[model samples]
Target: MARIRVQNLVKAWGDFRAVDDIDFETNDGEFVALLGPSGCGKSTTLRLIAGLDQATSGQIFIDDRDVTQVAAAKRNLALVFQSYALFPHLSVADNITFGLSVRGVPRAERERRLEKTASLLGVTALLGRKPSQLSGGQQQRVALGRALISEAPVCLLDEPLSNLDAKLRAEMRNEIRTLQQRLGITMVFVTHDQTEAMSMADRVILMKSGKVEQCGTPAELYENPASTFVAGFIGTPPMNLVAAAPKDGRLAVAAAASSDLVLGVRPEHIEFAGEGQEAVVAGSEYFGADTVVACRIGEQKLMVRVPGRPGLGTGAQVRLAWAPSNEHAFDARSGLRKSA
Candidate 1:
């Protein structure tokens, strides 16, 4: 579709800035996710891009054309909200064709668009079904179909999958990705779910308090976080962070019960050893494929994912160790990475 460029954007409410001056770009056919905690300005950024709300300052460019002041209708973007927003009284076909019909697209063109979209979304038989008759996941598909029928290069989704159950959400993630790639639309997704962002995005925009904490490929943020906030936010069984000092020729993890430095290792990257950093078992979680072992070394704890290690049950004594390279060094006071 079209490339979208956001430059030095700012959005404010009275004296409080909801979205700080930020810069980013989404390439043609790219699927970028704006991820953050609640009230972090991710949704505000989406509204700004969709022209649902105006920016307080800065510019927005779609296909290199300035449209910061464009009306939402003029921008021609397809936006799906967290709620499906489908018309309960309208049949699936009517819902999908509403956009075209409103724009005065002739019957022939509308039918053509509807046919292509229904087939793409596998809702051909669903045409006569009203929103109430369809399942939640199906309703979401129709919502997306409505957008797809627009054939706009840019698509904005505001947590379109949030309303579904876990299974439906999982299924829809793949469906959305497949459809996005098939249509080759430049899509901007806004969600507070880190797993969704990490699983589906081409690049992630991690936001905090209206400012960008970091923007990078999932691997980049997981491996080399720019700040302590990111370090704690990006991983499953997140990186271990404890206060530590690089002294006495070795670092002590202070949270590891007053050890020297905070030790950062992935849950899957840690190993149990007798001679390694001494720790007591704080907790354990067992999954069939693997078991997660949480070891408390001094006052701090680290989680390690191990396979076939049921022998080391909860409260068991063990030594936690990781490859030197697996360890991350952070400033004792700042908690920001000292070295990647």
Candidate 2:
């Protein structure tokens, strides 16, 4: 296993910068995920680390060695691409052993490694089949097996499960996490999906506009977001942000109709209170186990999540309340969390 460090990394295309001076480090055997929406530089950062794309400026380190200028082939890291990048004509065993073959590894050693990787990925029976003959999940396993057979200290994955169905994606998330833990390889996974990053990564490096937004464990970003963008990006229904002022222990419109404060409360945090902020129910969605009600406080909208069906109807008058500790305050001008 190896610790990967990216210091002052920058990637640019002409005048447009894709990654801007981003810095972070992954511990040995740690799973770090780069997460953000499309065009947010997560993929660019990953490619830079893989040596697939040259950075405009910065340095990359694998363990104690400076590999900023190292060739991709010499980096000694396994990479699993988004498309699986398998040769359709080759059987699973051949695909997995291609790296070994290229390196002229002994035939017996290659076979031994192949056996272990196949067993670990549960693709022992599919060794003779081509990628085209395999299911999506099976193909993903073969792709992973290819990387595992390399026995590299670092493993990098680029949206490896995005092509799978929702159920398969969830399954693969667990499988990949388990495989990383079992192998103790330092991993860097890039994904636009927040759920995948939160569920699979030991730590998440949230990015925006080619810059580092926040880097922390999943719980840290969810419970204590550093900025309004993160507050709106991390949750299922997202946190409800309303422009309001603290009034008589409740949030309400300011008498002056001007305030730089925004109150953030997660949909799950807002509860039905008899004495709270008055709002009109604009819409409600039933999700079998829970219901999300969209409430309108004047022109602003907020969502309230409740267990089961609340039978809330449109235009119904309701008061939304939440615990003091549950409320997050942000400055409207800067869109950053306000210190209490």
Candidate 3:
């Protein structure tokens, strides 16, 4: 396993900067996720680390050795691309051993690694098949095997599970995490899906507009979001950010406060109470396990998550209440969280 460090990294093309002054480090054997929406530079950052893309400025260090100027092949990093990038003409066994063959590894050594990697990924039976003959999940395993055969200290994955269906994606998530732990390999996973990032990574680096927005454990980011963007991005239905006014040294949702402050509360934190702030139900979405009721308070709207079907119809009035400890405050002007 190896530790990775990126110092003031920047990647630019012409007048546009794809990555801007980013800095973060990963512990040995840690799973770190670079997470953000499209064009946020998460993929670009992974490319830079893999040496597939050069950093416009800054340094990259792996295991305390500077590798910023090194070529991709010499960096000793195995990368699993989003597309799986399998060769149509090659068998799964051949695909997995391609790296070793290219490096002039002995046929016997290659066979040994192929057997071990195949068994570890549970793809030994598929080794005789061509990529076109396999399912999406099977092809994904082959791609993973290709990376794992190298036994590299660091593995970089760029949305490796995006091509699969929801159920398969969930299965692969657990498989990949288990593999990483079993081998104690440091992994840097890039994804736009907040669920993947939060559920898989030991730590997450959330990016926005080509720069790091916040980097912390998933719990840290969820329980203590650094800004309005994070508050709205991390959760399933996201945090409800409503206009708020200062009321007796506390914040309360109001239309007039849109200029001064924003109050944030997760959908799960809100509950229906006999007496609280008055709101009119706008709509409800019923999932098997829970229901999300949309309510409007003046000009602001928020969603409340309640177990089972609340059966609240449109235009129904309800009073909402939440614990003070669950409330989050942010400056409306700057969109930054207000400090305690």
Candidate 4:
């Protein structure tokens, strides 16, 4: 329905740059996530796209039409804020149809659209209640209904699930994804949660320090991170990055080589073996489905994910092995992935 593009976008406050020269585009009807930690500019990027904040420089295009100077209301975009900004004094029905009334859409049309959106989001029964009377999840649905009632082709969400509990967040994630697909609307979501971005988005734009770090599909990011920052950020237990050196024409931990080179391996890739690099167990955490074992190869720490509980005690010596192909090499100084 809509394709959004931002080119060389930047947002600055005097000496500070919140968003710095970022470029990315979303396919029509695609789900894209802006993911990063706090102060990383993901929310700023989303606001720039929604026309809520003006960019310091660059162009914004919607369906190939330049909307850099367009007003937020004139852009034909709907936004759902993280706080679920509903008026407490207004009933759910009135809140959902408020925008329509402000734009002077006829009462009949407003009611018709409100009914359709309420049904779509399963909030029709709560139309008479006020925001204060609704639970968090219900309030979220009402907020979504307000956005959807506009029938806008482009929707922007800013950490919409952050306020909900874990179970509710999971439920809303699926619901929102389903709604996007069912309506064929393009969506840009902002979140710091890697799980949310990896599970929902068709692609993820990971940001750091106001710059674009990596942009790719979830599988691509997981399989091949561009830097040590990405390697440490995208996983549940994250990748284990330890000092390494060249030994026997191959890289080995604690060997004498360039101190500027680092080795990265996913927690799930490392395995306990009969003979390999030796390590001492530091501790482990059991998560029912699997266990995350913390081990140290010399002074550097590594986390290994293993199936079931190994029941290894602290100070226990173990041999760790992983396929060479599973290893990732990075330049320690630059934090960039090293070419094989």
Output the number of the lDDT-best candidate: 3
**lDDT of each prediction vs. the true structure?**
0.86, 0.92, 0.94, 0.94
- Output the lDDT of residue 216, model 4: 94
Q: Distance from true position, residue 139, model 1, in Å? A: 0.6
The CA root-mean-square deviation of candidate 1, after full C-alpha superposition on the true structure, stands at 2.0
Best by TM-score: 3
lDDT, model 4 = 0.94
Worst 10 residues of 4 by lDDT: 249-258
What are the per-residue Cα lDDT tens digits for candidate 1 across 179-264? 89988998899988888999999999999999998999988888888777787888777777776756555555664345434556
Candidate 3: pairs in clash? none
Off by over 4 Å in 4: 255-258
Better of 1 and 3 by TM-score: 3
CA deviation > 4 Å runs, candidate 3? none
Query: What are the per-residue Cα lDDT tens digits for candidate 3 across 1-340?
Result: 7999999999999989999999999999999999999999999999999999999999999998999999999998999999999999999999999999999999999999999999999999998999999999999999999999999999999999999999999999999999999999999999999999999999999999899999999999999999999999999899999898877777678955355788999999999999878999999999989999999998889999999988899999999998888999998888899996
**How do the residues 97-174 of candidate 4 rate in per-residue lDDT, one tens digit apiece?**
999999999999998898899999999899999999999999999999999999999999999999999999999999
